[model samples]
Target: MVDVYLFSGFLGSGKTSLLLNVISQIKESGRKPAVFMNEFGSLSIDSDAVENGVPLKEVLDGCICCTGSEQTEAQIQSLLEENKDIDVILIETTGAAHPVEALDAIYSPIFADQLNIRGIITVVDSKLWLDRSRLSPQIRALYMEQIRHAHLLLANKSDLLTESEMATVSMELANYNEAAPVVQTIGAKIAFSYIEKVLHSTKEKSDTSIISGKGLPLSSKLITFTESVSRDDFEEWVKSLPETVYRMKGYVPLEGSINPHLFQYAYGMVSWLPEYVKMTPRLVIIGEGIDSIKYE
Candidate 1:
């Protein structure tokens, strides 16, 4: 049976970083891995980050838990049919997705017999969580739902917070999720070996006691740039963004640069990495009440 692991977290919680690391570790251990990535936008930006040659299936324009369950099951069936030797399948849910509904989607009877659900591993941004009170009540509740159902919790971005802050975050997370173990991490980094031990040894299945009746109202907008823009101008635009903009990521064509730069923004933090090859210059902005934000 193929072991399936579900990754749950809110927007910009470093799910992609953790997925990349897990993929590398699985490869090093001589096991074949497959991926099922879901995106809230029409275009899939994070799927580009997955290493080449890994069997990948993407569910786009919707969250898998709410409106994409049938689509997800079909994709997973195709993935298994195409790759008969896959030892494990890693599913990375959209940041706004709920864990219980995602697990429900995965329990399709058609392929349920062929797979063993390892567990749901959730990544929590320690900083955003600390400031969650500023978010709308709906979003805050969704965040708690994700954490409450995890089989393992990663207190990601631990380096950004002081020792006292981390201690507080760890204590709160442990108290809220006593069923799961909380691990403080930098960039969502944790020993994959340890993850295997915790998940593989767990005999309990996913808890569906509190499933979300509906998906969150989060939305995404895809912005395409026809030409390179000045780095200073882009930075200025980012600075002018409203706090409602939760996450933004894509390849940006920068003036005077030979290749497009990979740009990421999350919770007021921005980063740019130089890319060797030119990618389509586009950005996917996810948030609430952001339809009026102009990119020009």
Candidate 2:
């Protein structure tokens, strides 16, 4: 049986970073592993971060928990058929995906018997979790469910918190998920030994509680802008966005630049990748109250 490892988390929780690390360790052990990435929006920049040698497959523009289930299953079946020699598979789900729905998709009659679930690891942003007051009730519930159903919970970005804050975050996460052990790490840098033990151990299977009903309602908005933006203007606009806006990503040509720059804004934090030409330049902003954000 091929072992399937699923990694889940909220936006900017470092799922890709953790997946890359896990892939490297699996490769070192002489096991053949394949990667499956699910993106919430159409344009994806995460798949490019994977190492050159790892086999990568991507599902874009939808959440794997809902309309993307059939597509996800198809991808898995195809992956197995083409790479029959692979010993393991790694699936990195979108931040908004509910693990229960993903669990159901993976355990369908088509794959339940052929694949053994090695583990479901959910990465949580310690700082984000600490300051979730602005999040909608539905979003909060979704986030809690992701942590509750995981086989392991990683409270990443620990360096952002003080010692007292770290303890508080740990305690709250413990309250949310007593079933899964919480591991703290800086920059999602967790040792493979701990991960290996969790994946290979003979612990009891996770409870598939099916807590998410009617799937997740689309509570966020996705806005796109095609106009070339000024770097200073863009930065200022991003800084002025309301707290309701959670994540923004896209490529846009900056003033006085020949190539477009990739911009990512997560919870008021902004990062710009080196200028490069990739796809049509446009921005996708996802969050509540997106209309309130003025992009001049």
Best TM-score among the predictions, by candidate number: 1
For residues 132-157, what per-residue lDDT tens digits would candidate 2 score against the true structure? 87789999888887887676789999
The alpha-carbon deviation from the true structure for residue 6 of candidate 1, after best TM-score superposition, in angstroms, is: 0.5
lDDT of 1 by residue, 1-296 (tens): 78888899999999999999999999999999999999999998999999898999999998887788779889999999999999999999999898756765665544554677767899999999899999999999999989987878999999999999999999999999777889999988888899888766643322211111112223344566788999999999999998867667678899999888989787899999999987777776655445556678
In angstroms, the error of model 1 at 133 is 0.5
Best candidate, lDDT-wise? 1
lDDT of 1 at 12: 97
Error of 1 at 193 (Å): 1.0
In model 1, state the lDDT of residue 173.
95
Candidate RMSDs in order: 16.8, 16.2
